[model samples]
Target chain A: MSNADHHLVAGAEGHQPSLAHHFSSHRQQYEAGKLGMWLFLLTEVLLFGGLFCAYAVFRANRPEIFIWAHQFLDKQLGALNTAVLITSSFTMALAVRCAQWDQRRLSAFFLTLTLVCACVFLGVKYVEYKHKWEEGLLWVRQFQPAEAAASLDESGTSDQQPRHAGIFFSIYFAMTGLHAVHVLAGMGAIGWVLVRTLRGHFNRQYFGPVDYVGLYWHLVDLIWIYLFPLFYLIH
Target chain B: MKPGPSSGTNLTHHNDQPFHAHVVPVIVLLAVFGALLGLTFLSLAATWIDLGTWNLWLAMGIATVKAALVALYFMHLRYDHSFYALVLAAALLFVLLFVCLTLLDTVEYYPDIHAIS
Candidate 1:
């Protein structure tokens, strides 16, 4: 029977089945897994949601500052990264599919592909971030920004307010930095699962680990989907 | 260690399939993937037109649609039990409630603050 049915059977027992240490019976484990994932997602939303709210707060206060900040960012790279992430999510789904169907080799291959896409994402981010870094745009409080803004042909001091631009960088780094951390964490988790998958540990019924990990990975993509338009497209 | 008839879910009836057991899921997945990409690009293009403040909302709406598709088909929430659906719906509702409450707090003073800008 499915782990699902095990849960049903356990419920039928006079004494709710003894949950295994990991889980008393399969029921407790599955419920726990789903609940845990949701709770984790809830926390993630609050974390990112806080930043989004901050964006709104600041944008409301200084629309011009936010607009000018968007101009300085490389929109093309941001859009490319968006496509890369969407593709990565697709590959991740494929990996889960492979696991669901018991295609070990194929699953491992897709997981590897997902990792490579993650790497490419980080690489592109590195380049964009390096450009920002060299331009003295990393948002150190004491630094002067008008001089840096002047160099960007159109950010003429008249329309630009670089000092206020500091807030944008602060938010940008905070948001994207946290996202990168999630990507790194995802890579580590996926690597572990991919290893297990290669060893033939999951089948259609047992693909929960891979399936859930894929869910987490998609959340990463979900955040980026919002981030792209908020930071790049909106302005 | 516990020798049971099956450790987890009931065994799949793979015996009937001669050589392969996955023609349908693959076809469905690919079709969904293509549609997802199409919708994503459509949303991106739509963003370029001026919809005023509503543009973001529109884009968010389209993106949400894409997300639902992925969650339903690509993620196989489609084939999963109704019980999982209830769990997910509850969690999503809770998230909505959380966002709404947060927004309520922030939106209260938005007008007063916007006047300063």
Candidate 2:
């Protein structure tokens, strides 16, 4: 009930070596770590929120550009990445659960699976980006839709390519590019957790690291949940 | 005190239990995962039907459901302390406010920008 009582209880039970000196008990430490992780995640939400706001403003002003630009995005590839990331999130969740259950081998397995899914997602992204680059469908200033530009020069008027089309690609690259970077960062975190799990560092009482990383990974998937429809599935 | 199921009280510290971590049941995890995938495909299918402005709204609505499922179950927010949810909700509220105010300003000045362009 009180901090003193918690310290007494922890001492009676034999203090967990993992428990930090500042905390009275393992639960206190766990809760503090979790709360800190959530607060960090909150900042992450606001960070991406700024980009989403910019997207909304641009999309509102020029609906035509979004409608026209979305066609260039490969819906099939986008859908694949969504499924992949969702699967990774599922594995990450399982890893945390396994760690909670003190099943180190299973937890490590799931983390490896999550890492694989992240790599697969990035592989698909590389393919998509490469195709766009080869076709010259890049962000503003570098945007030059190969066939559309040729037709525009010949006719002096091209409905196929709307004015300021570059703006659409600009937002596209910015949103997806940032999301991809997060995915890469997630892989690094997952890799570290996997190594820790293999080293037998986590058990039922000490899985805060896995849980925190799981939350971060889920946030990454959350961002893509919105990005997929906003960029790829737009009608 | 012996380690057992948490009594679902005491936010700060669980002094009564040896260890406390909500191990989500496998069935629940699978169910949430299935629902997430189902909603995703449903959103994709919704695109086939032409509803004009509603298409965007419908897609967004489905995505929001998926996001909620992830946050609630996968992230363990539902079983976790209320303060975590409160923190997330506050962040989302600010995002909504930020977007709305920015949009309002842009719409108000659109006429001038349109005339110039």
Task: Please list, in the order the candidates appear, how each scores on TM-score for chain B only.
Answer: 0.72, 0.85
In model 1, state the lDDT of residue A113.
95
Over A104-166, each residue of candidate 1 has an lDDT whose tens digit, in order, gives 899999999999999999999999888778776775473356556777656453464634668
- List fnat, each candidate: 0.15, 0.62
On lDDT, the candidate that comes out on top is: 2
Q: What digit string (tens of lDDT, one per residue) describes model 2 on residues A1-235?
A: 5566766758854656676778666676777888898899999899999999999999999988888778777888888899999999999999898888788999999999999999999999999989889878898899978774675557754346677988988988898899899999999999999999999888666789999999999999999999999998898
How high is each candidate's TM-score?
0.78, 0.92
In order, candidate lDDTs are 0.70, 0.85
Off by over 4 Å in 2: A1-5, A13-15, A148-159, B1-18
lDDT tens per residue, model 2, B1-117? 222234134323443332566777889899998998888889888989999999999999999999999999999887776778899999999999999999999999999999999
* DockQ category of candidate 2: medium
What would the per-residue lDDT of candidate 1 be over residues B1-117, giving only the tens digit for each residue? 121232123323353321111222667777776776776677768767888878778877877887777767755566554454566676567666666666677678778865875
**Where does model 1 exceed 4 Å of error?**
A1-32, A140-143, A153-158, B1-24, B82-117
